[model samples]
Target chain A: MSMMKIGGWIKRILVLIFALVYLAPLYIAVVNAVKPYDEIIKSPLTLPKQFTLNNFVEAYQSSNMLELYKNSIVITVSSVALLILLTSMAAYIIARRKGKVYQMLYVFSLAGIMIPPVVTLIPSIKTLSALHLLYTMPGLLLFYAGTYFSTTIFLYVGFIKTIPASLDESAFIDGANPFTTFFRIIFPLIKPCTATAIIFLGMWIWNDFLNPMYILGFRGGKTITTGIYNAIGAYTSMWNLVFANVMLASLPIIILYLCMQKMFMQGLTSGAVKG
Target chain B: MKHNKLYDTLFLAPGFLVYIIFMIIPVIMCFLYSFTNWDGISASFRFIGLKNFVNLFQDASFFQALKVTLIIMVLTTLIYNILGIILAALLNDTGKLLGFSRSAIFIPTVLSAVVVAFIWSYVMQTNGGVINAIIEMFGGTKVDFYATPMTTIFMISGIICWNSLGFFVVIYISTLTTIPQEIYEACKVDGAGWFYRFFHITLPLLAPGITINCILSVAGGLKQYDHVKVITGGGPGGATQTVTLFGVEKAFEYNRRGYSSAAIIILFIIIVIFSIVQLAISKKHEVEY
Candidate 1:
């Protein structure tokens, strides 16, 4: 019994130390962001002698934080909303119907899951330019729709399979058309699945760096990731400004994850494990 | 119930149209473009039959990029899975310390890769870097992370693992929960020590999660761009460039669209082959619950 108690105490202490080590980088970022440039250089590991919000102010102005927030929010929101609607509708039909065509369509949708986005990026630039959507927000949105359609539909189809067909039949008997039944009846019941989709897709689209960098380019507005990259690229040696920008870029997502910690983990694991 | 064909078509058309136009069509175009010498801006180009693939096979830089990519892939996959399992097992209990540690580890997973890369860049910088600061405080030499291409790539791989290992850990922990307590109890009753139980009971039961994470991490590592881009921008004459970065630079910067497409297609093929092999192997070993 005494041995067991000693082992438990050791385990707890070890875990606590690991937790602090895990948080060390974040501590470095947070502390350095508020310190003066000389202070950061002098003693990065210590508590700041004096703190200021000047770095945040400078980072906000220089990086065009407002424009980045606007672009990121618009792209993430539109892409996620469109993905949810289109994937769920398609998944609904594929889930309900049993036919060769439906099965083929399901397989076709799953094809995108394995192909990395970089594979299509070069060719899509050509397609986008032809459609006059290149270097535009909507172009990136359509590209995301194409890229993520597979995984999103895969999730919805699996979830929709578990939801009984009786609900659809009842709605159809109530004088509802297929479209109305799906949107009004089936969509609501799949809230958990939709929540999962939203969390996964939302985080992905928001944090996406490569696609936005190429598709949006310089003339097109910058999303947070690209904007911060460009902003910090110029201020590389300015640790204070860099951390400030990092904090600005990451705070919203970090806070969101903390607030919805359980949902975030569930969404990520469900999407990966099931898909 | 009878299905309305029109409604089904309507439901599928929009997504299919986007998917086909942007995803499928582009893939086909990529294959076609690999045989052409079309500069991205050119209105017309000549048919270059197998020229890009032939050149890619001979190109030293292309081979270098391939080597770097594979190295990063192997390193990250090994670290994320091996370290992840250990961390998951250690932190599996429901206690404040365990929960807090889990959350701390996962926080970086939520942050953007770009952000994580930037934070680590500062931490790893040679002059007055956080790590170097502590080292110098103890009268140790500063380690230059960018001393050589290989060193830079390995350091970047470590950073990538640090940023995303939390994700794999969470997956393992979830998988750990699904294992029955009785198995561990049974092992304990047999006088099996922690190492023995872990090897006999935990490892085998965790195979499915291992397969998923291995595939995910391998694919992710093979396509690494964000961290390397922010840290080095594939600089010092493309020393640490991955296949994706090399392909992008070639296509956009040098107007070698055909060659670039071939490079990316090669990566695609490699990923597909590995994924298939992993699936097949995992299927053979999967323990039915």
Candidate 2:
């Protein structure tokens, strides 16, 4: 028992060390983010003796953050809503029905998961241009539809399979059509899966940098990420604004995740497990 | 009866049409473009058939990017998975301490990769950087992390692991929670101490998490763009560039459209082969509980 106690103490100390390494940079970031540039440069690692809000103000103004947030909100919420609907609807059919076509389509859809996003990104430029939807909201939405369709569908398919066919059958017998059976009976049941997809995809699209940088065209609009990237670029030496800009870009999503961390992690693992 | 088939088709239509038009078609088009001599802007180009593949093999930059990507991939996977499981095992047992540590470790997962990259890039600055300042305070000489290719690679890999380790930890934590306590008790009764129980019991039971983590790291690592792109911009003479970066540069900057497509196709083929080999090996070890 004495030996075990010693071992436990050693283990505790080692874990503490590892946790410090994992956390040091973030703590460093917060410290510097609050410090004046001179203080950060002089005593970079310490807590700020003098804190200021100057950086946030500069970052917010230079980044055009309100516009960026508006654009991001529109895209993330709309795309997530559409993705959940289409994926869940198709998933219900695949889970409930009996046919080779359904199985074939299911397998066909899964194939999309293996293809990397770049392979589609290159050729889609021409296609997006031709459709006159290049640099447009709907165009980017469609891009997301194609990009995330596989994972979203994978999540819904696995979950919807767990729901009994009896539920839909009873609805069908009670004079509900397929659409009716799906929306009223099946859709509500798959809320957990929908929640999972929403959290996962919402985060991906919101924080997405590269795709929107090119596809949406900087001149067309700026998402939170590209907005901050451009913001920081203009005021490289202005650490105050830089920190504020970073906060503005990240705060909303970070706060949301913190508030709903359980749901977020559950959604993350569920999507991974189901996929 | 006819209407059921129609309804199925109708329901599947919008989603399938969007997918095929934008996804399946573009991939096929990219594959086709890889065989041609199409500059990105041109409306007309002739099929050059295998030329892009030939050039890609001959290009040193391609090899350099491949080397960098491979290095990052291996290093990140090792750190994230090996350490992730150890961390998870420690955090899995219930205690207020464990709970606090778990939450603290997962804080990075909420922040964006760009933000994480920015913070690290600032911290790791050689001159007047926070880390160097800390080093000075400790009476140690400051080290320039970006001094060499290898150090730069390690720093970027560390940041990547930092940005993502939370994900692997959470997954492992859940996987650990699912393991019955009796298994550990039995191992203990057999005179297995902590290390022995870990080696003999915990590690084997965590195989599924390991397998999943490895495959994910492979796939995610091979396609890594955001962090490295933001951190180094594939800089210091494209030495830090990835395969994806190379391909993107070709398509956008250089307008070597067909050649870039070939690079992506190569990446796709590699991902396929790697996933197959790993899935095969992991399937053998995945013990159903």
lDDT leader: 1
Worst 10 residues of 2 chain A by lDDT: A266-275
Kindly list the per-residue Cα lDDT of model 1 for residues A168-220, writing each as its tens digit.
Answer: 99988888999899988899999989998998889889999999998999788
Whole-model Cα lDDT per candidate? 0.91, 0.83
Clashes of each: 0, 2
lDDT per residue for candidate 2 within A1-275, as digits (tens), equals 99877867677767767777778877776666777778876676678889977766666777889999999999999999888777777877787677898899899888888788888998887899999988888888998998888888888888988888878767767887888878888889889988888888887888788788888989669988887787777766666566667777776776787788789778877766532
Tell me model 2's lDDT, rounded to 2 decimals. Answer: 0.83
Show model 2 residue runs off by greater than 4 Å. A1-17, B1-3
> Alpha carbon lDDT of residue A222, candidate 2?
91
Choose the strongest candidate by TM-score: 1
TM-score of each: 0.98, 0.96
Residue B242 C-alpha lDDT in model 2: 92
